[model samples]
Target: MTTTTRTIPAIADQIVLVTGGARGLGRAITEAFLREGARVVIDYVTSADAAAEIVAAHPGRAVAVRGDVRDRAQVEALFAAGREAFGAPVTTVVNNALADFSFNGDARAKADEIDFPAFAGQFASAVQGALHTVQAALPGFDEAGSGRVINVGTNLFQYPVVPYHDYTAAKAALLSLTRTFSADLGPRGVTVNMVSGGLLRTTDASAATPDAVFDAIAAGTPLLSVTTPAEFADAILFFASPWSRAITGQNLVVDGGLVKD
Candidate 1:
């Protein structure tokens, strides 16, 4: 008898759908996937020009689609559009779209000051959006009998450094969904996971964060530097690869060791 290990599939063989992939951390993730030869669908609620540029840069390997993840119809249509453009089903889905937000700790609402509307809005974007995408992608997963779902998360739930209360709460719910979804989908040959990142050094959301804060974060981290969107994006790829076939319902934090968990 001989024993052999399964190797991860090449990115070129995977068709991926990335939400909010037109800019910020999503852009980095899309580019990384493209570089690895993956056929990518960049889903954007706005940022038309940015999405166009990414598609242009990648030529036939990438396409940009407009969709609001919070809207179930739009999400379904987005997946349809991807299939139409690529002539293949999307085997991987990355839920990286964030609700509109700025990382200005000074301007963030304190717990007592935060309102129900704020929480509701974040939940719509973080939790509801994931639900829409996952539900939309299920038929594809069923047809293929295999699929990958990588949800973008945040380290703030574990290490509430500045306590962006609403954002953190929504992501906490997303983590719960990650676990439950994995359990439900595991038997079907689908894997669900999360890649949580601390405040990235330079992204549109974090652009308002003070330079001093970035420096302080770098000094405290084991890596002695603030993590970049590109670095965080790389961690997302691991969850989507065949190497992670047996690993589901896990949250991998990519923040230069800022949070021990």
Candidate 2:
């Protein structure tokens, strides 16, 4: 299968599903995909009003669906719902939704105090959701012979900062899943990859973090700056585009040099 140029022929018509796309970096990813000419499905566990507003802005270009990633049935149904609205065999998926992320704040407990339950909670969101999602989308990909999964992971697993063990573990697991899926799906032409980032300034997910903390992070990066959602989204788009057809089972870090590969 040959990939098209910067703008693929069917790419604009692609049905791109993004989990947790109602707000934050996910929202930016959704908007960017829509702007790039793909029909987008914005999946959210909550944030109904925010999702509605986003869909309203995009009209035919977007649709919002709600389902908990922790539940397998819900995850399957979420993909089904997306397919029912935009037709089956979605060309791409962006696994940007995460749980237990609201606690990455200065006021939150330190790494030593975090419990195992909290750690499990984080994986329940990504691992469970991603597994079901890939399962649900498998047949479609097999039929199409070409599909993409852009897993949104974090750089913390590579560069730990005081051990937010749970979040880091989930991301690390996600990276592993990416590699395995890439190999498993390669024969059928399905590409699986990850785009991870360091701490970001704004987003419902990052609201708990303090501004001063982010400033410190920005100072610590080799680039001496923070990466924006737009920059992160660009990396995601690269994986979806034909340019990255040869790349798979890889993690693209977009943290302004905070974590180098």
Candidate 3:
């Protein structure tokens, strides 16, 4: 089918859903969209208080819903909740949910020690979770005649600076899905892309990272700084905005120039 012809909506006109949006890097992404005046639906499996507080802060522009992205039924309900709150279908979706994981490389299982289940758990969160979200968002996209899918990724897949194997592998799979989904959905005016960031300086997931590791990453980067969630969120905004209308199936790294590719 030919992509329906329509004007790209401004960021303020978009209704956005961010999975795992109550805390950490996800919270940063949620705030970034709201700052642009977009109505936001914050999805969380926990962190209800945090999510509610965010919604309270934004008044009518933001709402929080609890759902697990790995489940299809819950994902559909998430969209319904968004529509109920905003009176519009979600025009953008940010699949940023991650399973329980920490960034302490010292505590990580080496290749020989890491089990298949570890990879499976990560895949469920990173790849399967994204799959459920995209599938659920498809109807809304078809209805609106356009949509944006921004998958949160990691720079480790490219650089493997610390090799958190399972987590990095799952993100890599998600990237492959990003390109394929773009090809399949582009005809319907949907764009699928990824924004990969390195170990964010202070996200909950990265809290376990030692100061020396952080400093080393900063030292290795051309900018001599570790990427922050807010900085990474800015790139996510770029993909969701009208300026990126023609771009799809691509990965943009926002790691302070640490990974050149």
Best by the lDDT measure: 3
- In the range 1-261, model 1's lDDT, one tens digit per residue, is 753344445577889999999999999999999988999999998899999999889899999999999999999998898889888788899999999999999999998898999999999999999999999999987777688999999999999889999999999999999999999998777889999999998999999999999999999999999999999998988888877878999999999999998
- For residue 132, what is the lDDT in candidate 2? 75
Q: On residues 1-261, what C-alpha lDDT tens digit does candidate 2 reach at each position?
A: 985433332558688889999889988998889888998888897778889998998887788889777777877777777778876667788888888467465555576787888878888887877887888777777666688999998888788764677788988999999999999988778889999988776777677777777888899998888888988898999898888878899998999998767
**Best of the two (1, 3) by TM-score:** 3
What lDDT does candidate 1 reach at residue 78?
A: 86
Local distance difference test scores for all models: 0.92, 0.82, 0.94
Q: What is the lDDT of candidate 3?
A: 0.94
Q: Candidate 3, clashing residue pairs? A: none
Q: For residues 1-261, what per-residue lDDT tens digits would candidate 3 score against the true structure? A: 644565668899999999999999999999999999999999999899999999999999999999998888999999999999888899999999999999998999999899999999999999999999998999998888899999999988889988899999999999999999999988889999999999899999999999998999999989999998999999999999999999999999999999988
Model 1 regions more than 4 Å off: 1-8
Top model number, TM-score? 3
The candidate 1 region of ten consecutive residues with least summed lDDT is 2-11
The reply for model 2, stretches above 4 Å from the true place, is 1-10, 103-105
Residue 176, model 2: Cα distance from true site in angstroms: 0.7
The estimated TM-scores of all candidates read 0.96, 0.91, 0.98
For candidate 1, the lDDT comes to 0.92
